[model samples]
Target: MEIDPDLQGSVESSHDPIPTVVAGPSGIRPSLYAASNTSASTSTTSFGIRDPWRVTPDFAPSVGSSSGRSVHRSDTWYPAVPSESRKFEILYIPDPSRAMMKKEAALNLGWTNRDITPAHFESIKHLTGLVYKTGRTKDRVKVLVTEWLWILLQMDLFENSEAFDVRFMQWQDFRAIILDPTNDIEGWNMLAKVDCIIGGIDYSVDHSGEGNSYHLNMDELARYESCVAQLASQTLFWPPIRLARQASMKWNTICHLQMIARLHGSYTPRTVRLSTGQDIPDDVVLKRSHSECAKHVILPTASRSRRTWEYLNAHTDKYEFWMAQEYVQSLDQIGEWRVFIVGGNVISVVHTYKTSDDGWKGTVTESFLTLDEIREIVEKEPTPIRPADLRRKIVNPESGAAPIRSRARDDFMGFVLTTWKHLVARETRDTGAKPSICLFCRVDVGIRIDMSGQAPPAYFVNEVERSPNTSIWLRFHDNTMGTLADTFAMVFKRWLMDIRNPYIL
Candidate 1:
């Protein structure tokens, strides 16, 4: 069956079954097809939990479908199965043994013993195992995995180093060494040597093993060097302030230019302007109230907050308020839902919340807490408490039991799925057929309490993370039920399979 050119970008389609066969490295194959109009049904169980997985019958047809109808915009969008012939299967591997082996290998490779901690090795192993299990050629896997490890190591060094100027200088030196081909074996530190080795490995992958002795032409080398230098310089000069108006613009421009030179793409959290119906670059912080913005303002020179409206008035252009009508705010609580989507389906949901008094604006926290403990605090505390102040034992979400099913939760999940589909349609319309945006991504939804308290809380799209951090899954390995690693493996395997298909690519 051929997809209608006009309808290709839309997520909705007619009742026709589009045969899709998914095959993965593990050899498990599954066949999926779009559901017929009559087959779609929505029914609620006695527990009041709506089955979001059930197909809804009111889905609109794609532009070129037999009905020739377009989907209608509503307060909440609904999911529709696409007729496109895309399928994928997932394959996952356990990591404890793999991490141990890699730790030994790093030691033999002259890595400092102190730098190779168990936690660090495990992190490396998880990423490497992900690449290996997804069926990358052995040589390619080694090179890519090692490069990732090296990047992580560099990040750790920059973060842990006491002297920022010293670390910046080292980064400059490292960038110079990487760009120079003939400067071999003079006086370099262990980190510099490791950087050189990583570069060599990357080149070897590109040349299919001939890169061991390969040297780039002067022009190509100059361009590569320039790109690295720009990235390093930008990082060195990034503003310490969270959301300074001019500083953010400068940093974003540099980042975009660097990505262009590196042949990569970058994304920022989406910021929609309600008045102009346009997307502008801005950051939104949801707390107790919109007026709370006064409490969070940073002075031009220091980290302390300044109370004078004169300060803001002095810099009107640099401090304009860009509002999103969809911004979710509540009187007692502020939180967001993290919905993980794999192969166009919502696989997992995590609710992160903080009380109004906590002072922290977002869902993310440096400290950890279990769902039960968090629930207890919410139930008992008359005022919000910071997560860091909690003294209870930490429990990873992976080991915790499934969240108690509820209609409200189901509705939130449905809203997230719908938002993703809408965003995907917009992306496709803007940038033709790009497979990268359709794969695994995370959607963050901010929750706002209904004023009337007659229905569930309203959900608003906060942002979407295309490349979410995967280290959190490692915490779920010890779960008696299905671990997060298992879910990730399945989803990642499927994503890899999708990319491998020439049609999808």
Candidate 2:
């Protein structure tokens, strides 16, 4: 983990702006890669060139240098972490009965022999043990955990695939099941069973149960059900094709649906390299011209328009239109924090940084570096450098790659946890007596620049997922023994605590 400062410097300076090739008057241009080589050959004197998409070295100030004050806007807020600590018993062992139940559930879903692989069974067993620790009955645990598997399977089947028509059909059927639970289609599939499990969970807390047993009140349960329904109805059912169609015909509806998807946790934003060295057209630039500039100028109508247009057109001709999803465009950073909250308390936090090549839409890996360390790492070797390539350089030898602890880091964690608390509170207030808006879920918050005052940057929630992948568990226990066992134990423990001691206003 001892990175040579020289190596870091070399990497930091290596990111030269990618040379772009604009189409000439003939409407043809050399390939971007070829133009890049030509540009490099022409500009040997320019050193320390950086990609516009890559975060600058000074983009993130050192955490220690921050004022340590929580900056709140009228639209933004953060929740304070609880001072008290409670220890709960953890169960790591998998049960045979639960394993059998999972197999049965899988079979009931029409999973063929080929579909129910050993890996899927292992996943079921692991997850079942986790949910069992929440003090649910064998049957209840099986249903809940099985539903998780079903959701994951469906996401894998449809979301990542190009078969839009099939996804749309399946989603329509799934939406029906969610909206009307009593529909008794003869061949009720796994998703149908998932709907039933979600709809039927007894949210009433069983006060008579022994320690570690937990249950949500009816209202709390309803809230969770609503989230599941929305996820299925909005996210799953609304195919990309439908979204595109709505964009033109029903812009507002599309925006609302996109918001729901973001709230329910869609994929993390990744940066997109639209086209390297492509010039913006004059008409496109003029379309974006400010009226104030035209008003201030005193030249004759024709000359003023011509000069102003030419001046504005000069920069447009050399620009690259690197773009991201709307949600990403709203944020200021390429990294986001995934904070795991249970019972309104932050249990764990991980920083995820996106690679540069994909814009804001690429895969991210957990980074254990502190804000300062992260700055150094990015300065040295900008991401979307592959994780495998950056691992050895970013990991700290002393902490064995555990997340670095610092005052700035703590403040950030507090800010995210607090923001989530406020968001849940607002949801509850708006909904009025619904099930808890979020009993146990992951909240993804993007770090955004704040210029409202002299305050430093702040975090803004980008998405909330009721059933986020528990992959953080794997990353947290990477160097530990029985990582899978630990993952199940911790997940169940938090879930149980969340139910038993539900967050209150």
Ten-residue stretch with the least lDDT total in model 1: 236-245
C-alpha TM-score for every candidate: 0.36, 0.32
Model 2: what TM-score?
0.32
User: Total clashes, candidate 1?
Assistant: 0
For model 1, the superposed segments whose C-alpha errors exceed 4 Å read 1-327, 331-334, 355-410, 435-437, 452-457, 468-483, 497-505
lDDT score of residue 412 within candidate 1: 47
Query: Can you write out model 1's per-residue Cα lDDT over 296-324, one digit (the tens) per residue?
Result: 23322332222233433332231133232
Candidate 2: misplaced stretches above 4 Å? 1-196, 199-334, 345-347, 356-404, 433-438, 448-457, 468-505
List per-prediction Cα lDDT, in the order shown. Answer: 0.31, 0.31
How well does candidate 1 match the true structure in TM-score terms? Answer: 0.36
